[model samples]
Target: MIHKLKKRRGIPAGPLRVIGSRAQRPGPAVETLEIVLKCDSFGTVEAVTTLLGKIGGREVEIKVIHSGVGDVTKNDILMALTGSRLVAGFNVGLAPRLEQWTKEHGVEVRLYNIVYTLAEDLGALARSLIQTEPEERILGRAKVIATFKSSRGSIIAGCEVLDGVLAHGRNFRVVKAMGPVFTSRIESLQVEKRPVREVRAGQQAGLKVTGFVDVRVGDYIECFDPPVGRRSSAWSPRGAVLRFDENA
Candidate 1:
């Protein structure tokens, strides 16, 4: 014989209990999170990818969506953050319109005013995340990298390559202590008064910039390169910039 319990919603509702040798409850479903990395300059691609890979490995559900050099429009913002919890690595100064739109849409976005250099921006963003209070101020270095042309149209630069490789015809910045002073292109590269195709880490080289003039010694130089597949924990010598080479 079996006991018939009174049904409430097409089922018995009385203690509503189950009996078994071992009771098992379903585990919570894992969530799939996404992130979007938008970069305009090629120099930042590798460093940004390395940083994201590290973060992704630590967080099981998080994923990174990589975007290339281009304008970040309102549509891009909406699509990227539609179901994401965080947005980062966007240059607010270059996309003022998009920045305003993000603010209006109630999306949570972290704005990095510094541009072109991925490693520097990543370090800055990581530091900001640990702060107890959020500050509206945007922090960045003032040094700029510029390439100018001599009378013979040879590219000349009086700047320091802050990070990555500076190749011919690459885009760079001429910066002062306040912020970005100018945007220009590299016309030619010269090292030790000798013309060359590329400059590597710790090498002081001169460049011919397409735009602007009066390049100074103290100015910062930025370069663009392909994304790096791996990262090293080893610290480079102080004041030394990194140059990515597949063979090396």
Candidate 2:
């Protein structure tokens, strides 16, 4: 029986209506990132291909498959690099030397032990290529000096504004000698027992925190604003996508 060959690249074209007795080899999509699959078992390859095809839709093209670890060779990596494709493996681990070589040669490879995680990762990668996401930026820092127990069963941190201005009702993180311990918002702020909206650098203020209680006297406090949305545009980092090839 002759099966129709479908084009998965550029503008959609009608499937090639051909007539042949034997099955023809499937081709990777030219317009999308191609993926090569390596699995320990043939069944795993079939299952993963179906799952990825459903989740990735038309954004990803996974066509090459190696049924066993021994079937993987340098040729696979060369094909991947030449075609600008990614190689993914399931339970077919690569040797330490080969893994290092791939990294040094700038080959894109990832291993996954779970099926759903692979699909989710592929979907996320596809979305990231075209979607805008939010990223965080630090705004200010403070140092906790003294902790006072309030009558209302809450702990307040007497802090010295370190870097930027510390404002009331803003998000804050408590950093200990080891690392960050808690994150909360400032319930209130006061300077010398007088209520204030914000405290500038090198100033001392008292902070009432909500959603945390273990703030220590020597801990460092850091404040951060809400994450700002960043979209990938021609003028941004997303526009100049870098592709490295060590073999070049």
Candidate 3:
């Protein structure tokens, strides 16, 4: 049996209700660049479309929202506005008058007579769109064995490196039996009363922490750092929000 649909585009637009634009496909590690392609003929359209498909690598994706065999028209530019704001013409050109209109609309239109040049331009465009995301890696871990006040009145947790190396100026998370307490960057790390940059596994060191002082014995400390050249001075709590379970 067939049933009537409930909503289209948004909650059926009958009640003067206002809704935001529809969400496009989600972005991923490989960014997507949408384009409206117009060529002189269907054969050229198919050939260029196939070439564009294999142009981008895993970093960026080139998607053709619409392809047709004709000169660039207002409709094609409109489609580009809703997509990547780009239009490519192969062996075709936009009407002379539409040039000004396209610029005012903030849409880009590229006309190419040579297929090789077109492919080269598109390939470079894809590379330009590649976005490099910050990468994170755990530097080391340790367990708090004691706590004491430093000469500067800052609280220092005496920790024993349990598995990995712990480095100063790296972000850290203090976790207890209950859950994670807080996170901050390690301001100071030392061994035998001397300041040190890092401590390897099986080594005992004093770690000075700012913005938090409640570290307790038996608490685990996780130290992490972003890739080199990436900003590491700021810290964000990766642990889930703390909630007490009455049943537990």
Tell me the number of clashing residue pairs for each predicted model: 16, 0, 0
**Candidate 3: pairs in clash:** none
Global CA lDDT computed for model 2: 0.62
Tens-place lDDT per residue, model 2, 172-193, is: 8889999988888877899989
Whole-model Cα lDDT per candidate? 0.47, 0.62, 0.72
Local accuracy of candidate 1 as per-residue lDDT tens digits, 13-62: 22212211112224643323444455546555445555544431221233
Report the Cα lDDT for candidate 3.
0.72
Name model 3 segments beyond 4 Å from true: 1-33, 43-83, 90-135, 149-154, 210-213, 226-248
What TM-score fits each model?
0.30, 0.42, 0.51
Q: Among all windows of ten consecutive residues in candidate 2, which has the lowest summed lDDT?
A: 234-243
Residue-wise C-alpha lDDT for candidate 3, range 1-248, written one tens digit per residue? 11224333322212111113323445556666777788888777778877888877666767777777667777666667767777788766666577766766777777777788778877777776765556878888899999997655467899999988888788888988988788888788889999999999999999987767777889999998756664332211121111122232
Put the candidates in lDDT order, highest first: 3, 2, 1
